[model samples]
Target chain A: MAVASDTIAAPEHSAEGRSETIAFLIMTAVLIVAPFFIYPLFLMQALCFALFACAFNLLIGYVGLLSFGHALYFGWASYLAAHAAKVWGFPPELAILTGAATGAVLGLVAGSLAIRRQGIYFAMITLALAQMMFFFALQAKFTGGEDGIQGVPRGKLFGLIDLASNNTMYALVVVIFLACFLLILRIINSPFGEVLKAIRENEPRAISLGYKTDRYKLVAFVLSATLAGVAGGTKAIVFQIASLTDVHWTMSGEVVLMTLVGGLGTVFGPVAGAFVIIAMQNYLNALESWVTVIQGVIFVVCVLLFRRGIVGEIAHLLRIKL
Target chain B: MFEIFGIPSNALFSQLLIGLINGSFYALLSLGLAVIFGMLNIINFTHGAQYMMGAFMAFFLLQYAGLSYWWALIVAPVVVGLFGMIIERTMLQWLYKLDHLYGLLLTFGLALIIEGVFRNYFGSSGLPYAMPDSLRGGQNLGFMFLPNYRAWVVVASLVVCLGTWFVIERTRLGAYLRAATENPTLVRAFGINVPRMITLTYGFGVGLAALAGVMAAPIYNVSPQMGSDLIIVVFAVVVIGGMGSIMGAIVTGFGLGVIEGLTKVFFPEASNTVIFVIMAIVLLIRPAGLFGRTA
Candidate 1:
């Protein structure tokens, strides 16, 4: 009976896996072809946010940790990257690395403090810390205060390839997005990821099974932060600006909104969510606070009815993973 | 006036008074959060929004209904608390069965909607609420001047906080609340309406926040974003104090406010972050908090 159950589950799992791959392939193809039809600037912004959301999902979906202040990682990294490029005269690649490194360090400090608390306290702690950082950014001289470090030069990717043109920047963004997305996929499917899931499912049980759950959580947080930094850094370069908007509590909420709308645990959910949310904000720019109201309504509705999110629901209907 | 650490006595004393006033709001708000968390096992993210609502309620009453500050003091919290009860019934009750995070998310969403709507109508600017005729002007304490309205806020919030503490920690009703939190099923089996108690408890906690808001209108700007900003600091206060003890929340709230005020006098740049920094240190030194019992 056990063997029969195992055999039945194996093929279904494989089918889900195959569907996920197909979805990724299709998503990549759409992203590649998207710029020609849609505005490249919008697409790049969406892709950066998509990457940011994916990094955020790494912690929330897989680890069952809802960080209410991911904007700390994304926003600070953007500032650092822009500063590095514009002030220090670094190449784009080096500037982005600086941003990622900042994310890792901040993640270590934040993760250590935050992991001390469980559930709701964890969320609150993250938010408070992020707010602290927001104030710091507002006062810090290096951050340019309210104006932020603007007019960041889109230097060469590696001191060789010119990235001034929209097409080149778009290509570079797509590459970075794909690379990071795949890395996240690889991380989630690894032995490390299984333990993360184990910890998430039952931390005490994982401890009983001799897992140092905190270390795993910390590592996952760092990795997530690093990727978020990459996205933020790329955004700074592409947009030629890194401002308070990226680091604000609202930005953190926006990332959470994207993840919630996309499907918390689904692989493709954040990407789909990022695109939808970014598109809405772009189109609804005229409505001002109404956009906030609409986003809030979406949040309420998503929590109440569409908990599985866009991709999650579709995956469920198709009986496949996304 | 004498000097303390190169700062004049009057400057220091006035800042201390300002801190005390801010602390009063913190103490009240955190107290409400602790009560709600005790019963509901959820952090009331909408507490901030509700507080904002209370202030807006006071503003609306005074503007449209020709109500006085005294009338607002009595009326605003009840109205806002009733609204809180409606939310508890319609939205919050549904979330009790799921992960606690959903409660936070849902409340956060509600807060966003409320703040967004208010901002749309009122814009980001603050509206002034007039001080009651009963509590106007200031007093000279020889070293520093004391504003009567500010002093009243401190006293009122303190009375409410201590009164709440007495009821929760001393009364027979408090025992039932504690019992319900421990085991709702057991409490319900004993013929008590646990669900209604839970709803009422949430409403009461929210009312406490509204009361603080009504008090705050005279001191701070009656603006939509005020509550959200203050709520983050209150969350840090809750963290440092830990949620396990009611006294912890109260003490931490007031203590942090004083510390914040002191920081402003000394290291003005760090004033915004001193509480958060203390929270981090607290988490490191005593993960369970100063007064919290480790679960």
Candidate 2:
């Protein structure tokens, strides 16, 4: 089971070589030109969510782990970064790093706790833990409960470059998102990624092969959480607010939707998925009340009929590795 | 004058009673989830929504049909159970051959739809469900005054949980069900209609949630969001108890409830998070859960 599943690792192999070069060029061109066709802020938001979803995919696709509490890391890190920048007057870059570090620590604790059980139990454990954090945030003084930590200052990037300007901020976001995306791609192509696939396919076999599977899962989980935090923290800087919405269970569900719609386990699928879903959400936000129902319908349709998702199906039809 | 750790005995007992009451609901919901998982191998993410539906069904029954709580007790489960059958027959049955996670996703979608529609129609605010007149008022229990309705909820849930255990563990039908759960193909070879049984099993599990909902309506306000929140806590209870044994689920549910209640008295700040803390500790101590078998 481990060996057969390891074949999926080959996809990551191609992802690192020429494919990555093409992807980098395309993404660079898009980032450079996106502001001309679209609002820079909207593009920044999409990029943030795209990075969040990709980080999430690292766990579900490669490790076959479905986390229902990812919102905890995203939301908590956002809160941390927001507090640092808004209250403590930290630079934007420092705030982002604070958020990422917070996520890594949270991921370590949550991952250690969740990895005790496998499969559905793991998902439920993470979800329950996240809910605990939700309650903590609800009652904690700094969170401001329903009001949340609002009107956060973006501050200058590295205490030099002002992010008050739209274009400057957008460029900063693009740089961060691209770096995170490339880092994820690199990690997935490495031997570490192959081992993760091995554990996902067959845990006992991987253990028998003398691979300390738990450590790999923990590392992947922490990495995923840290990246998700980066996205959330960046969003806080962009929007100048970090609220309960980021940490809510619905946010976790939205990440799952992005990954599923994009293509689970595919490198670029989550990014594309994030763009499509965010665009759909932007359109649906106009209706406001009806959005939940629409989201529900999409979930049903996706699970039942479109399981392989848009990119996965396209890849299959084209016979080109996604 | 009597104090336990600087807290009044009355306060502690009252919290313990509240804990027991919460535990009863947790036991009922987690038991339902475990039973559904047994045969279907799918976590019924819709269990919470179904529980909420039960409360709504009761509300509708009383408002439109002029039915009493007695009638609701009898009719609500059947109504929700039938709904469960429909969902299983049309959507869930098709996914049985696929990964179990798909079932979780599908039910999650169903839950969102149900909760969304209800929220859209009723708004997020809770509706009042009057306790039956007979179960109203309080009983003087020496140390603490126990609300009759609260006491009844605990007893009733206990009866239902035990009754289910009896049916699944002792009855010939239960034997067949267990046989089917272990090896559906082999059980089918014996001419048992395993698919139909599977559908009904889902109905039965759903019915258990509805029963809890009916029991809970008067205590907690009948709201669309009620079940969704409670369901996550119950999932934690299920994890702590380890879904390996029915008794384990029941005991853990009630035990955690009491523990949470005690936390409320000792450290009110941590009341909401005590169960999760316990869950983390349990994971560290016994990863397979207290009664769960090592895979």
Give per-residue lDDT, candidate 1, residue B107.
Answer: 89
Tens digit of per-residue lDDT, candidate 1, span A192-250: 98788888888998898788999999999999989999999999999999999999999
- List clashing residue pairs in candidate 1: none
User: Looking at candidate 2, what is the lDDT of residue B193?
Assistant: 99
**Candidate 2: tens digits of C-alpha lDDT, residues B81-144:** 9999999999899899987778888888888889999998999999999889998899897888
Per-residue lDDT, model 2, residue B167, is 90
Q: Write the per-residue lDDT of candidate 1 for residues B8-127, one digit (tens) a residue.
A: 999999899889989998999999999999999889989999999899889999899999888888898898889999999988898889999999999899999999999999999999
DockQ of each: 0.82, 0.73
- Deviation of model 1 at A124, angstroms: 0.7
Predicted structure with the largest TM-score when compared to the true one = 1
